[model samples]
Target: MRKLIAISSGILLLALSLAWWMNSRQPQPVELMPILTGQPEYCVTCHSDLPEISASHPVETFGCVSCHGGERLALDADLAHSTMRGGANPSDLSVAEISCGGSSCHTGSEADDRDHIQRVMTSVQSTYAGAIANIRYTFGAQTDLTAHQGINAITDERTQTGITALEIFNPTLESNPMIQKFGEECFTCHINAVPREGESYTRQTGCAACHSTEQHQLTTAISYTQCNTCHNRGNYDLRTMTFVERTDHLTNRLEEYYQPIAQFTQCEYTLDCVDCHTRSEVMGDGDLHSNQKDIQYVQCKTCHGTLTELPLTKTLTDPNDIAFRMAFLKPVVDLKLGDTILVTEQGEPLWNTRVLPDGTYEMIGKATKQKFNFRPVMGTACEQKPNEQESHFCHECHAVER
Candidate 1:
């Protein structure tokens, strides 16, 4: 019995050693997993340990080479990186069509629901074309707003100025030093230009301007700090038409730098920029606008219940509203047919909500455990019968905690 046991132990040990040798002989992470579409990729053989970028993009399904155009089959680093579209960034507008976009992806076409590239191109934010036109016109260098006009090319054109309707201001060609200086100094924040090289957070431009957070994650629950990158930057002198660097560096409030130049009520400081700016207002609902004001024309009366009336309905039908939806898609949350009301994140009034045993009304955020309490504004202090309840008026008395 002892002899037999010894022989068995020796055989097990030899088998284990052979298995280890076989594993060691194989190339480290040489397995190329095929995705749902396109060719097999080997990029993950090296970047298998990279941090997750977002829930939207899964390395397992999309693979690195899908958005980032590189020689996927090449094992050598030089050959692999040879055809990289935008260095480490593929979402950059410069190469988005070939990188982040595809026929089924954000391919600059409205036929697909995921046409992000198409919408962003026409958006005022993407086409700083309007602002540049206005500035050049104001300087008397152009005959009209149409002179030196630049706009997004509706077709397959994809350059900095969106295929260029006409020649926008080129600092090298401009005879006026002021216009040249303005082009050099003031044009950094536009979504078209590539972000500054250093500072990863500051370097996230184009689609990343809003979707990418300070923590370097792609998310929708954005805050005021995200808006600070551009909105709360250096002061612009209205009197001299000059732009000056900010004195202080620490702050999330626009008032810290924009004070005296622009007025902000206490309400502006209390809530987030998204609180008032609806999805359409911020993201542009497939409709092109002239300027920032035209795009973000949200009024205070929209959210805060108006005088003598409530803006939102309080009735809903449950089981239809979900926990999660698309970036711009909101839940169906405003059903007037029933006794209870539920509001979707996108402000859509649909049939969804429930009734509690008690009289108080409540709602759960879509796909989240967070709850919202609904109150009628008809009897509240805001609904004075004969007076105007404008934003500036209420902000004077109801100040946010410092």
Candidate 2:
């Protein structure tokens, strides 16, 4: 009995020592009390090496629990991550309303230009409506090219276009085998769809699809490479119902920017997609559309004037102007009140562009931050006709050899 008691005491002592050593190896709990929630969180204890997410979303303001819905107090890795909102992405549409929405955040009044979530939900990128419409039309599943279905059913209350709702498109329900094949194969490029499994097709779903980089950092300075993940990665072989990946080893920016068959000018490849495409064009105008052409109205004449007239100019007079808000988001150019800037045909302001004293326009690249001074074709020696001011027409004379 005495020997058994001694052995039991020795085992207990060894267990206690092991526990003490493990506890010592664990990191000290670093408490953070965020101003937004006024709640204390210990996430920094484990994630001490992570950099600040962005300038706007400060750790001191928005603690990890706010965006990444994990346990605030729990220190164990599993317990901390068990209740995470979207597993590594909080901006995912599945939980965006709870994680990133609110009147103060992304889902606010359209008049105030804060309805980002709603706009994205109704956007063609998220719906994949155009591709569906085309495939169904080609395969005789639908009569016209109008979109009647999307990946998921969605309704827009204040639709400017005739289409106010889109029914959920189910590939299994589709009768046409070609349409079914299209649904099965061509559903990977949408913002809501999980991208194809590869290095080239790597991208997150929902808002992060466009706003976040591979590092999972949110940014407004989106580059051409980010857009290429979906736009220029590969083309689909409709005959075989398979996506053929681009096997060409690109040597220049022009080749890297677009596919070989595409004809583009120097500026098209020189500037990033975000540099020319407006917020509404890329994100959506809070309405459902049949195709990209319906929303994308940025013509060549929008920046470069026609031979008959100069480009439309709007001077910033109102402090509450949308241009000011746009400039605040980008911050590449300082847009002061009373400064004249170019406007699109639809009256959207080119916030980064400004008219110089010499009548030339200066534009700062949204992603690259490079400055370019250009004069409109109004007084130039160019022979472009007034009526033929489309980008394709300009490409006739300006297309660079690929």
Candidate 3:
């Protein structure tokens, strides 16, 4: 009886050990499902509006998940549905080599954030045009405008590079290579929403912010009409008018073709891809107007800040007060740094600091005269609601609104 009992106890212990081992060795599957509903679609629905990015390749119909890895159908805001984190993962781009730039899109060893956006846009467009031709002509005939433009009998024929309606496409023209505006770059003319000094927060704006376009008055967003933002009316003739009178920079010999100056010259200064050509000459071959033979042409401001464009502002000499009230007249202004402003006869102030949130200001003392009025040394003023008496709150007169 004792032997039988010992045998039974040993068998029971062995069974328990086997069960524990099996449980420990079992593998658990990782949860890669998305946490949010209508995820990839939600992002795609809006991103598709960007024609250069959405009109071609798998992205035309495929959702964000196709390029930017993530659960396309996620319903929650969890890590499982995350697309890119700490630069580890990014969208599966079509041309992986083109992802060298700084941006949230692709984080690679070769990526550069400085102008990644422009490079990406240009690459995507070039790739798409090539792909479309492959499908339509099967063997890359003169199907697209690029080919026609490239093969034009007159090397100086005009073509499109996207921004303005101007057909300033001339192969013979030299370009400012550093001013990547002619190619797929965005910031060459675009601006991001960022915070401003004295102002809590401000939306991103373009040249149109300060420069008003009679054509775009009804529109809320900035437009090219605001060209004087940089090229003021006074300097317009100097930049545009002067270019036309000079000998063709492409062909050293005087040419008959008129170089189109479509933009307001000041704000719309960057050249599109066609502006920088590999096979064109402007002025006679060996003159200052000729293109660089071996080196790529770049804007002086790009690598060298020799021609720094400082923001211009109107003088605000407070005859009564000693401090000067300088105001920047750009599209977006910041008051976070704190400034002193004087109320103008118009509802607008003489020196508009940065735009305030909620379309209102923290009026401390009387709007007119005070020790500390929320104003900046430099800024511009815009049209405001007109009233019989200027609007003022007691708090703005007494309390320091920072």
Top of the candidates by lDDT: 2
lDDT of 1 by residue, 208-253 (tens): 7776674335665556666666666665453454666556654555
Residue 106 displacement in candidate 3 (angstroms): 13
lDDT digits (tens) for residues 240-270 of candidate 3: 2221123234341111121332212221122
Q: Give the total clashing residue pairs for model 3.
A: 70
What Cα-based lDDT does every candidate model obtain? 0.57, 0.89, 0.27
Any idea what lDDT model 3 has?
A: 0.27
Clash totals in order: 10, 0, 70
In model 1, pairs of residues that clash are 314-341, 315-335, 315-340, 315-341, 316-340, 317-352, 323-366, 323-367, 333-342, 334-350
Q: After superposition, how far is residue 148 of candidate 1 from its true place, in Å?
A: 6.8
lDDT of 2 by residue, 123-182 (tens): 999888988888888888889999899988999877799898999999888898888888
Which has the better lDDT: candidate 1, or candidate 3?
Answer: 1
Top-TM-score candidate index: 2
Candidate 2 Cα errors over 4 Å, as ranges? 1-4
